[model samples]
Target chain A: MAKPTSRADSSTASAATEAVLGRGAALRGRVQGHGNVRVEGKLEGDVAIDGCFAVAQGGEVVADVQAGSLDVDGALEGDVTVSGAVVVRAGARVVGVVRGATVSVEEGASFSGRIEAEFDMPPELGGKAAR
Target chain B: MAATVIAQGITIEGDLTADDEVVVQGTLRGKLSSRDRVSIDAGALVEADVTGASLSIGGQVTGNVTASDRVDLVAGGKLVGDVKAARLTIADGASFKGNVDMDV
Candidate 1:
């Protein structure tokens, strides 16, 4: 598989920022970003970020989240669009439409959705500024 | 002192902003903001805003959550909020709902 785009310059790890959906956190809206994202709480709406998105264990989501890639381990209810890969861990449950180039779901995981995918990360992540 | 642990069966209502470690195994209703580690134990129920340097969840939450360092949603956990964190890990048995921001 091709490498994913870097969210930060190789030299500056602090150049990155992440928004969290903490355990008991909740929101009802849409989100758009130029970076990565991780969901560990609960949400209801849409998400469009330029970087990767992760749904951790114990986390739950019900929205349409779009990002470069997605690594999920929990429960999700909605539609997802991943340009790169979508990894679903064991015991995770997902229900919706999914689009990605690479899709991997571990045993014990459950999913019910649509998927379409194919794309690789760029090489020069630390080279230019994206708007 | 030790961290604040909300043992199972306990519940609170209000926002939380702490400077030390905290563990929730009960229920909360409000906002939670911390400068240290925050943990939500299994069977816990939280309904508040959450913030911390590092966060770990193994329960249920219904609010907004922000972690500066890392956020981990362990198995059997349920979350409902917008997330912001540097590192995020969602393992098996987790459920969530919200928008996420991980700027790089």
Candidate 2:
């Protein structure tokens, strides 16, 4: 009876369904998944996920990343394409084109790339274009 | 635990180097190097050279394995590669076809 209960608890723990790349870890290749991921290490591959992605303070990524949302607190040297939002926190360094629905770079974050946010064309811009 | 888990349905193709433990339940097709334990859960498919402190295989592995501590091939596991470890154990129902180097 106690073992069954423990198994149930473990199953519930697995329900969190998030992947973690811990500190001192290095992954070089393609990472494709359906759940969110938090990186606290080094990743040198393309990542395509259906959930949010986060690069922790001590983490570094050198590959293109695609996710539902992205939060960076480390160094990223590749393009990023997100369906939701992209946030670059303080002390982060990102050097690549960023495309998202909403993108935010914190004050202390260093970013050297183009940002393409999807938005409807304003009426003034449309009028100017027509003229 | 704060170990890394390669959840089911996910596929990783490349080299993975970790200082912490790793549990794989998905598909991994590359090199796995860890300073801690590495576990291949049942139903997982791994085709990579593995180097770790300890290794527990309950799935299918098709590469060389080098463990500093020990290697355990659990029941229903299938391994088709050489093994280099200090200690090794093979369960009754496991299938293994490889040379084992225990360093004598």
Per-model clash counts, in order, read 62, 0
The superposed Cα distance between candidate 2 and the true structure at residue A17, in angstroms, equals 2.3
As a whole number from 0 to 100, the lDDT of residue A114 in candidate 2 is: 93
The CA lDDT at B68 in model 1 is: 87
Query: What lDDT does each candidate get?
Result: 0.71, 0.89
What RMSD value applies to candidate 2?
6.0
Q: What is the lDDT of candidate 1?
A: 0.71
lDDT of 1 at B98: 87
User: Model 2 segments beyond 4 Å from truth?
Assistant: A1-15, A122-131
Instruction: After superposing candidate 1 on the true structure, give the runs of residues whose Cα lies further than 4 Å from its correct spot.
Output: A1-16, A119-131, B1-104
Assess candidate 2 and give its lDDT.
0.89
Q: Report chain B TM per candidate.
A: 0.92, 0.98
Candidate 1 contains a number of clashing pairs equal to 62
Per-residue lDDT of candidate 1, residues B10-103 (tens digit): 3445444455667776666766776788888888788888888988998888887889899898998888888888788889779988877775
Clashing residue pairs in candidate 2, if any? none
Residue A99 local lDDT, model 1: 84
Give per-residue lDDT, candidate 1, residue A119. 45
DockQ of candidate 2 is: 0.74
